[model samples]
Target: MSGTKPPSALSSVKITFLGTASAQPSSTRNHSSLALHLGGDVWLFDCGEATQHRLQKSSVKMGKIQKIFITHTHGDHIFGLLPLLASRLNGSGGTAEGVEDPRLHVSTGENTQPLEIYGPLGTRAYVRNGLMYTHTLLGAPYVVHELRFPTDPLGDFTTLPRNAAELPTGRNIDQIDGHWPDVFADNLVTVSAAPILHSVPCVGYVVNERPVPGKMDPKEYIPAIKRTKTPMSVMSRLQQGEDVELADGTILRGPPRRHGRKIVILGDTYDPSPIAPIAMDADILIHEATNAHLPGIDPTTKEEDTYETVEMKARSHGHSTPQMAGAFAKRIGTKRLFLNHFSARYAGDDDVNAETAEVMNAIGSLAAGEYGGEVTCSRDLMSIDIQLPK
Candidate 1:
């Protein structure tokens, strides 16, 4: 399977931080959302409030979103889901000025495939009820797959009473060795999930791309092929791991395969060690750091603001400090650590205030203390590209 496509077909993976705030959004941050761009398709991690608005500002296209994975149903994490789905239903057409108003346009010749949404147990009910109560007749069909746990209550899996837009069935989430089943997969990538320690039944995701064919050395093969009078079609077959017999009856072998990149994205959690096995040796890890304490930089040196105190408080609320996020990245042997889900009190990296810049630096310093990898404190609209290893 790895040698099916040429190495040039390998898509570049990029992550855009749509929102980086924790529970409450500050002026600089919106909420908890991330847009992962793989090839031409987009996979949204969490759809917090104004996620659609954020998409408008980002390079991610609303029509290109193929799937949405909700970690948990926290309001800040999922408030914008309904609106985003509704927008997808509405066609891109609008007034001559190209301004889109949902009320004005229902469906204007827009053809879209069914959107797939994956989330915790209550997700189906929440989406169905929200659409039904709002009287939103979608222009396109959608399906919601709930990842149910054993402790969750058993309920009727029915579509909305009046609306038949939702598909009846969804995938079930069963556990095995601390990992849930593979959430999704295609020729491009495979996505797996694991239950992480959070205030609610939250899950973390790992996206692993399929390996690609190694680069064929034109210098080495072209000379031999020309001498044998081999057709160009033989080169394509050889690149696909097929032994090809040339015009002179000479056999040519394909190049070795190269491993694809791995990306790990987690929701808010105090401890995410359960996913370490699957997340091992990831190229990039996006972990949440809702709170942190820096002794010298922080003005509040009070007893309650000590490192121990702040860490305890953060863990009690099912959150993590920068140190905790970094530790988890180290545990999983991630090459790059990106800290997100910051408290509103800390200004973003874009802020011009010296004090806030110091705070952000302190946060990165704290995480760097635990993890020796490249640490980046993510801000709203920040984009990072992950290229395949040469």
Candidate 2:
């Protein structure tokens, strides 16, 4: 549980933190950007300056970023979107405006998946107006869906998994089911989005594991013991979640199953209360701590104006502090609270040696420590690998 490495590019579901600094840039950290590696593509969360450059520095292929989800339109949140899109299009044999792929590398797969972009109301303006004069065009093999909404649904799973399937499969809306959204799955991970309270319109994302029920172990099955037609018939029943009806009127039962791990990353938020249910018992919680203080509007006393004491700067701006981050992690019962968007507090000092203690006093270490969880500050190009807890 303590020793795990980030998955390689060949992995089906993985996440990489491209940049973890806050609004300002420093030597140790950049801004806020994360790459979600699923199926064969990387879905970007936020694009700060040098985001595409960071992608090149890591193992993520620029071609794999088929989708990009922006939380808000702040310069810290979106400065790199135009540049990254341009580089990707420039590299893919096209100018940057929209996607247009003449030739694609396709295996003997059952489906063709298109690229998609989802963001706040001004997303089209950023693409059509701001980047339109850049002489860049998209040349992918499939469709390029660009959507802009006034408000994002906060912490809702009903539409997220379904949309991820649809944008790739070209399935009709009537056929899409909120109950299950794997209709267009291509060996990819499931991603869900919800709205969070920030200074602007922001959304948080949760990436879940869709079971490869197709790859379950066959050696432990009773059907492998039997011969002839009955054995094959029994195997089908087990996979389909059906009870085996025996010739002698006896039945063989199937056991219930457990779920894989989940990772939640809230781009930048003011209301973490809604995240409790979404991140309940999550393996890891990687949240942005932009503001270091809690938020409140009080006229009576100093304590009335604050909700958290994780940082001092958050008192004026709406951001999270290390202490506030710990409170949210404790409430959600996460395995670990990886604090990114670090201020200049650590200042090149090793957190394992000094920063951890500062954070414990700033926020309560007892909160995160109760469940064997910890607070690890993110550094530039640092990789945290999550594996199944043993």
Model 2 collision count: 23
Compared with the true structure, what per-residue lDDT tens digits does model 2 show for residues 128-237? Answer: 44444543444332222332233333332122222111224322211112111221233335655555667776656666664422323556565533532355556654
Model 1, position 1: C-alpha lDDT score: 38
Q: Per-residue lDDT for 1-390 in model 1, tens only?
A: 354454334466899999999999888898899999988889999999999988898888899998999999999999999899889865232345766445442332335356889988878878878787776667667778777776776663555552355654556666676677577877768898988899998989899887776778767678778898776767776665566667777777887767788999999899998888899999999999998887777675465577888999999999999999888888889999999999988778545778878888889889989997789899889998898867
Which candidate wins on lDDT?
1
Minimum summed lDDT over a 10-residue window in model 1 is located at: 101-110
Q: Which stretches of candidate 1 lie over 4 Å from their true place?
A: 1-9, 91-112, 155-162, 300-303, 349-351
Runs with alpha carbons beyond 4 Å of true place in candidate 2 = 1-12, 91-113, 141-189, 211-224, 227-255, 291-312, 344-372, 388-390
lDDT score, candidate 2, position 61:
89
